[model samples]
Target: MTISNESDPFYKRLSLNLISIGLIAAALYIAQDILLPLFFSMLLAALLLPAVKFLQRKKIPKIVSIILSLTISLVLVFGILYFLTTQVLNFLDDSDMIEDKFNGLIRDAQRWVSQNFHVGIRKQNQYIHDTAEKIKTSGPALVGQTFLSLTEIFSYLIFIPIYTFLLLYYKDLIKKFLVDSFRNSSEHQVVTILQECQNVSQHYILGLLIEMTIVFSLNAAGFLILGIPYAIFLALVGALLNLIPYVGMLVANIFCMIITLISSPDISNVLWVGVVLMAVQFIDNNFLMPLIVGSKVRINALATIVGVLIGGALCGVPGMFLAIPGVAVLKVIFDRVDGLKAWGTLMGDPGADKQREKLKDAIH
Candidate 1:
C-alpha cells in the first residue's frame, strides 16, 4: 500500500524542519542588533584565549593576564589607527595637489577605457563630474554619518575588550558550568561539540594572524619597491581589510590605486600599483593563505563566501568578518551530531574529505 504524501514520515519531518528553520531565521533577523555585539565579543574571546592561556602558563595571575592581553590588543589597535589617521591628515593637507593628480589619472583612465572598450571619453568625464557634484552635495551629511559610525565603533571597541576579559577569566568556570548543568548522554555529546568548536576557533584565529602578517609584509615590500607614498599605512590597511575574505582584496586594490593616483599623476605609477596589488593577491590566494591557513577549520570556499554574504546582509562588514569562523564552529559541532552530519559534510572542504579517504586507505 502506498502512503499518502502528507502522512509519510519523511515528508512530515521535512515540513517540521522547514518550519523550524523559518522560525529561526525570523528570530535571528529580529535579534540581529543584540546578536552582532555578542557575536563579536565571542570571537574576540576566542582569539584572545590562546594568549590568556600562554600568560597563565607563564605564572601570571588570571586578572593580570587578562589586563596585559587587553592592553596589548588596544595598543596595537590604537597604534594602527594613529598611523592611519596621520596618513589621512597628510593626504588631506595635500588635497589641492592630490586633486590635480587624481584629475590627470581620471583622464588617463578615460583614455584607457576608450582604447579598450570603445567608450566615449566625453561621457565618462561627464559621469565623473556628476559623481563629484553628488559627493559635494552630500559630503557634509556623509561626514556626519561617518562620525556617528566612528562613535559606535569606539563603543564596541570598549565593550569587546571588557567582554573578552571576562570570558577569559571565567572560561574554565563557564565550561565546567555547561558540562555540569547538563547531565545525560547528550551532555557528553555537548561537551565534545564545545571542545571541537573551541579548537576550530582557536586555530582559525591563530591562522588568521599568521596570514595577516604574511600579507602585510608582502604588501609593504611591494609598495615600497614601487615608491608608493605612505606604504606602511596602505599596507596595514590592506592587511586588516584582507581579514574580510574575498572582497577585501578588491577593496585594498582600489584604495591602493587611488592613493597611487593621487600621489603621482603618472599612468605608469598607477599601473605599477595595480600590478603590485595583483601580484600580492595572486600570492595570497595561491601560496600564502593556503600555506598558513590551509585545512585548519575544514571550511570550504563556497560555504565561506556564502557565510560572508549572509553576514554582510545581516550586519555589514563586522558580520562578514565573523561569518566564516561562526559557520566553521557550527560545522564542527554539526559534524559530531548524527542528525546534522550531512550538513557538516556540506560545509566542509572537499579536499579535506579526499585527504581523509586517502588516510583511511593507507591505514587499512
Candidate 2:
C-alpha cells in the first residue's frame, strides 16, 4: 500500500489548526480592549496572592488583606512615578540646551548631506520645513489620540484593581468552576495543570520584578559612574523597555545612545553608555535572569521573536508585553495535554533539550 503525505489525516489536522489560529488571532484583535485589562489584572492578582495569604495568616480578613496588598503596590508604583516625573521635569528644564545641540546636529547633518550627496543646505532646510509643516498640521490629531489613550489607561486604572480583587477573592470558586467544567476529564490532570499555572504565574511575575530591579540598579550605577545626565530616568526607561525580550534591549540601547550623544559634550559618552548597557544585558541574559527567574519557560529565540512581532502587530504595546508569558502558559498547557508534546517542543529551547539529554546520559 502506498501512502500520500498530502492526503494524510495529518494534513487535514494541520489545515484545521491553521484555520483555528487565524480565527483566534482575529478574535484577539477584535476583543483586545476588553481582554487586555482582564489579562493584566489576572497577572497582578497572581502576584498579590502570596502577600494576601501572608496577611490572612496574621488573622486579617481576606478583604482587608487584599486592600493592604493593593495599597502597598499602589504606593510603590506612585513613588516610582513621582521620581520619573521629577526626573522628566528636570530634563525638560534643559530644553534650551537640548535645542541648541539638536540644531547643531541638524546643521552638521545638512553639511554632510551636501558634501556627500550634493544636496544643498537650502534643500535640507526646505525638506525640514515641509516635514515641520506636515507635523504642525497633524499634531492636533496625534495629541488627541494620546489624550484618549491616557484617558483609557486611567479608566482601566479603576477597573483593573476591581477585577484583581474579585479574582483573588474568588480564586477557589474559579478553580472549582474550572475543575467542574472539566468533569469528564481526569481530575488529576486538571488539578496538576491548575497548580502548575499558579506556580508559573507567581514565579514568573516575582522573578520578573526582581530581574527588573537588578537591571535598573546596574544600569543606574553604570550611568552614575559615567556621570550621565538624567541617569536614573534613562536607567528606569531602559529596564522597563527590556521587559519585551530581545527587541526591547536593542531599542533601549539605541535610545540611550541617542540620549548620550545629544546630552553630553563628548561623543565618547555614547560608546561608554553602550558598553555599560551591554555589560548589564550580558549579565542579565546569562546570570541574573537564570538565577532569579529560573528557566521554566524554555522558549527558543526564534519563537520569542516571532511571538513578540505577531503580538505587536495584533494589539500594539500591551500585546508585546503579554506575548512571552502568554506563550509560556500555552507551552505549559501543551506539555500537559496528550498529543501536544510536539507543540511544546516547537516552542522550547533546543539547547535546553540537549542539556537535559546530556544529563540523562550521565545519569544512565
Candidate 3:
C-alpha cells in the first residue's frame, strides 16, 4: 500500500524542519536586541566555566566564584579598552602633523595624475570639493548613527556581565532544562550534546585568544624592528581586527599601510609596512591558525564563509563573531542526531568525514 503524501514521514519531517528553521531565523532577527547580549554572555560564561568550577571546588560559594570570574574578566577587558583609548588619543594628538603630510601626499598624487592621466589639478580639487560637500550633507545622519551605536555599546557593557553571572550561577538549572526539553531523545544523548557544545565553545574561544596574543606579539615585534611609528598601537589594532576572520586581516593591512603613509614622508616605508604585515600574516595563516584555532572547529571553508556572510547580513559584527562556534555546536548536535548526520557532514571538513567513515568501517 502506498502512503499518502500528507502521511509520509519523510515529507512531514522535512516540512516541519524547514518551518522550524524559518521560525528560528525570524525570532533571532526580531529579538536580537535582547538575545544578542544573552548570546554574548553565554559565550563568556562558557569560557569562564572551568574557572568557576575550580573556585567552587576550592570551597568558594557558587555566587562568589561567579563574581570573581566576572570581575577578572572585566578587569582584563577594561585594561584592553584603556590601552586602545590611550593609543587613539595619542594618534589624535599627532593629527595636525598627519594632516599636513596628507596634504603634501595629495599634491604629489595630483601632479602624478596630471602628468600620466592628463587630469588637471583644478579638476581633482573640484572632485575633492564635491566629495567634501556630500560628506557634509550626510554628517548629521552619521552623527545620529554614531550616537545610537555608542548607546548600544553602553547597554551591552551593562547587561553582558549580569547575564553572564546569572548564566553561570544557574548553569545546572539550564542543563536540567535542556535535558527535560529533549524528552524524545535519551538523557545521555542530550547531555552528550550539551557537553560537546560546551567543549566546542570553550576550545574555540580559548584558541582565538591564544591566536590573537601570538599575532599581536609577532606584529608588534615586526613593526618595532622596522621602525614603524605607533608600532605598538598599529600592531594591537591589526591583531584585534584580525578576530573577524577572512575579511579582517586584509582590512587591517590596508588600514596600517594608510596610517603609516600618513605618518611617514618616506614612500618606501609604506611598502616596508606592507611587507612586515604580510610576513606576519603568512605565518599566522600557515602556522598559527592550523596549530591553535583550525583544529578546534573543523568547519569547511565554504560553510565558514557562508556562515560568516549570513551572520553579518542578519546581525552584523556580533553575529559574525559567533558564527564559527555556533556552527561548530550545531555540527556536534547534528552528528549525534541520526537524522541530521548528513547536515553535519555538509558543514564539516573532508578530514573529519574521512575519520568518521574509518570509524564506521572499523565498527562494522
Candidate 4:
C-alpha cells in the first residue's frame, strides 16, 4: 500500500522544498531585468548608507544626505573613468604610429592558404571581397545592436543612482516590508535575518573597498618601480578586474599583456608584467584578501566557486560582483529556517560545520 502523504513528513518536506526551489528559479529567470537593477541598487545603498546616516545625524535632511552621498560616489566613479580615458588618448596616439596587426597575420596565413587549398592571391582577394560584402550586409544591424547595448548601459547607470538614493531615503519602509512579508516567519527570526543581511552587506562592501585600494596602490607602485608606462591605468584596470574573483586576475593579465605589447618600448616589458601580476596575486591571496575581505565573508572554497559561477550564469558581470553577498544573505535565511540549517552550514564557515554535525548526533 502507498504511504499516505499526511504520514510521510520527510517526503512532504522534500517535495515542498523542491517546489519552492523551482518557483524561485522561475521567478529569477522571469524578472532578471528588473531584479538586477534592484539588487545593484541595494548593494550601492549598503555601501553609501553609513555616509547617509552620518549626515542625517548631523541634522542633514534625508534628501540632502542622499544627494551628497550619491554625488560623492558619482564623482569618484567619473574621476577614475576620466583618468583612464585620458590615458586612452595616449594609446590612440600610439596606435596611429603602429603598423596594422592583421597585416602580419594575413602574411603568415598566405603559405597555408596557398599550400592547403592551392589558392592564389587574386582568388584570396575575391574570397575576402565576398566576406566583406557579407559583413556589409549585416553591418547596419550590428551597429544598431551596439547602440542599443550602450543605451541599456546608460539607462542602468542612471537608474542605479536613483534607486540607491530612494533605498537609503526609505530604508525603514523597505525593512518593514521585508519583515512583514513573511507572515509565518517568527518576528525574531525575521529581524535576525535582516540584521545579518545588513551586516553582511556592510562588511563585504567596505572590506572589498579596502582590499581594492591596497591592491591598486601596490600594483601601481610595483609597475612604477619597473618603469612601466601608464602605471596607474594598468593598476586600476587590474584592481577592478580583481573584484570578479578566481578568473579575474587571468583576464587582467591578458589585458596587461595587450597594453604592454602596444605601449612599452621593449618587448621584455610583457614578461615583467606577468611576474609583477603573479607577485601581486600572491600577496593578495595569501595576505591581504584573506585578512581583509575573506574573513568578513567566510564563504568556503566550493561554495564560493559555485556561487560565482551561478551568479555569472544568471546576470553576467553584475552577478559576479553580487555572488558573495547574495550567498551570505541566503545563508542567513537558511540558518533561520529550521530544515535548511544544513545547507546554510555548507554555505558558511566550514570550521563550524563539524560542530553542526556533532550537535545533530547529540540531539538524535
What would the per-residue lDDT of candidate 3 be over residues 292-350, giving only the tens digit for each residue?
76666888888988888877777888888878888888899889998778788899887
Specify the highest-lDDT model's number: 3
Candidate 4, residues 221-329: lDDT per residue as tens digits? 9899999877887898899999988878899999997777666768798899888988999988766765666655777778888988888887777788888888878
Poorest stretch of ten by lDDT in candidate 3: 352-361
Steric collisions counted per model: 0, 0, 0, 0
**Per-residue lDDT value at 358 in model 2:** 56
Q: For residue 23, give model 2's deviation from the true position in Å.
A: 2.6
Each candidate: RMSD to true structure?
4.6, 3.4, 4.5, 5.9
Candidate 3: regions farther than 4 A off: 1-18, 352-364
lDDT of 2 by residue, 182-259 (tens): 889777788898887777778888888889999999999999988987899889988989898888999999998997
Model 4 TM-score (2 dp):
0.83
Span of 10 residues, lowest total lDDT, candidate 1: 352-361
Query: Model 1: what TM-score?
Result: 0.82
What TM-score goes with each of the models?
0.82, 0.92, 0.91, 0.83
Clashing pairs in 2: none
